[model samples]
Target: MGNLMEPSSASVYDGNLASDRVVIHVTSHQRIDQQILVKWRTKTFIARIVEDQEEWIPQFLTQAANFCGENVSRGSPKGSLGSGTTLRFWIDTWLEDKPFYLLFPDLFKLESYKGCLVKDRCTGGGEFSQWEWSWIRPPSTPMEIQQLLTMLTKIQNVTLSNQDDSWRWNADSSSCFTVKSMRIRLQNASYGPTHWVFPWNKFAPHKVNVLGWRIKMNRIATADQLAKRNISTTLSLCPICKAQNETAEHLFLLCPFVDYLWSFILSWCRVSTQKPCNLKDLMEVHQKANLNHWTQKLFQHVILSYIWVIWKTRNDSIFLTKNPSLRRAIKDLKGTSFFWLATRSNIPDLNWEKWRTFSF
Candidate 1:
């Protein structure tokens, strides 16, 4: 072995020389140390020293640049964009700059303003919409909301519509009339006790439902139940005649009493048609008939009056009250029909003498 601490000198060596072998090993170790120093320096450089620096700084700079560009484009004042007086900016810088006044000249006109404000003050503007407009301000005290609503409703009756033309209602008219009328009737303060036969609370669109409830209250099984004894869907025995089966067709339309009344009315109206057997078939025929508005209204009112009189007469007989004569029933129907027609503003100029001449 060569002296371990002695510097190895460059010299040509035999292939098996030990000193040559030692020199080669020393050179290899030095090269490894130099590589390690280079690696350490590369890792310690400031660019790579901080964790996440390379990843986060570029993103932050890019966002900052974009924000600055946006601020410059909008001509924003020299402060944080989010820290400005938002309401002031909106009113002054945005709204004031628009030409809205020029485009909507009538919008600020006194007449238009009066109309808009009048609607707000009037009744029938629902509570929610009224509240939104601040027309009817929020109540400050407990139960004030209810009190205000009540007062508003009461005032509605006197100021709801044009008194001279009470029947007229345009689309823009206040809904006060309808609402107040309904509320008073529902409270039963306006109409008398004699008018309270129909249960207004339970009344709905379905005629059968109304009649069914009435039937239930009387504790009488419908004709359908009687028919079930013989496995039939139809009840065959006229409630009025007792000579004919009480099918809906016979009871409402084809019975002799009803047929005679209907025939008289049709002849008076100067219209002719085959008689219908049921309510549905009657309605279908009426739909096909080409009648003018006044005639149609007269016919409808007549039909309603007839039905009402018949039902009332039936109830009277069942309750053992004074039984209705055919003549009396017809008289009541005609009077009621005429009263309803006269109330409508657009009643036709019929031959009043001819109608009055017809004996009930």
Candidate 2:
């Protein structure tokens, strides 16, 4: 019937007791006076209650206290407080009071805070503060933002260029090209974020086959070898001379057979005989040559095609049901190079018969 306080003892009352200690038997009204009753309790009693529910009390009190404090603080001296302002200000204040701002000297340095503000326009603070907390600082103009993005993208591209894995196996030079341009023609295609609309689904079978061969060549003999003998174990015999070492250098340039092929190709192209001992060195010679742009690329492609064809012929002899004759091999190399050029580029007419006249 009533509430009563007893110091250092539990207050016991009969059903008819008349005091401020009103006990409501109904569960629905238990929370009605809980706040007032809690405030009236002695410090010892409050501590005991806190101890009993310490696990959840802190969070509960924090939220409730924030809601009440904001409602009270935002009340105008001459006007009633609005529901929206009370709710908004409460949440804003609570967020501003979060431990991050209290502990850290620079809130912008924390990735979590930056990410949060970037994702949501809300900070436990004002709108201006929220904007300031974003990971990307506001640019002076749209152009400035674009410039910053461009600079960052350029840096990323440079980083990728410098990475070892980015290099492709450029057979002509036995090195890599920093960039490659691929011509794309679109048919019944849609645009992507970066590239134009092209029917990639309908890729040319020949091109796919060529690409596969390139990838395979790039992966071949990646491991380091101490001697030419180690190379011979992998490649049966010297691809050039069919004698001596079968290492990459011997197979490509040093071997007598390859030396003969190089001489023949160079003479046919009307290029000087400046022989190099290995593919790497041969490429350097080609690079330094006073050849026109198209001519240089054409020559490089021709050399690459020759190497690829030679390797294919070797594989055919070893695994396939046929052996390649010198005359047939030369013909195959010339034909393959011609077909590649015809399909991939427009070039001066090549005289294959004249090219093949050079002997091994």
True-structure lDDT of candidate 2: 0.39
User: What does each candidate score in C-alpha RMSD?
Assistant: 38.5, 28.6
In the range 1-360, model 1's lDDT, one tens digit per residue, is 122123322111111122211111212443344334323332343234344333222222222222323321122111111212221111112122222222223322312232232233444433321221232344645455554455445334322222211111111133111212212222332222232333221111235335433432332333554565655533245545557755445556767877777777677666666776545445344444567654554454555556566666655654565545778877877776565545543534744454555322
Q: Which pairs clash (backbone N, Cα, C closer than 3 Å) in model 1?
A: 236-245, 236-246, 237-245, 237-246, 238-245, 238-246
Per-model TM-score on C-alpha atoms: 0.33, 0.35
Worst 10 residues of 2 by lDDT: 177-186
Q: Which ten-residue region of model 1 has the weakest summed lDDT?
A: 163-172
Cα lDDT tens digits for candidate 2, 111-189: 3343231114333232222222344444445555555455334323111111111111111132211101000001112
lDDT (C-alpha) at residue 270 in model 2: 69
lDDT of each: 0.39, 0.39
Give the clash count for each candidate. 6, 5
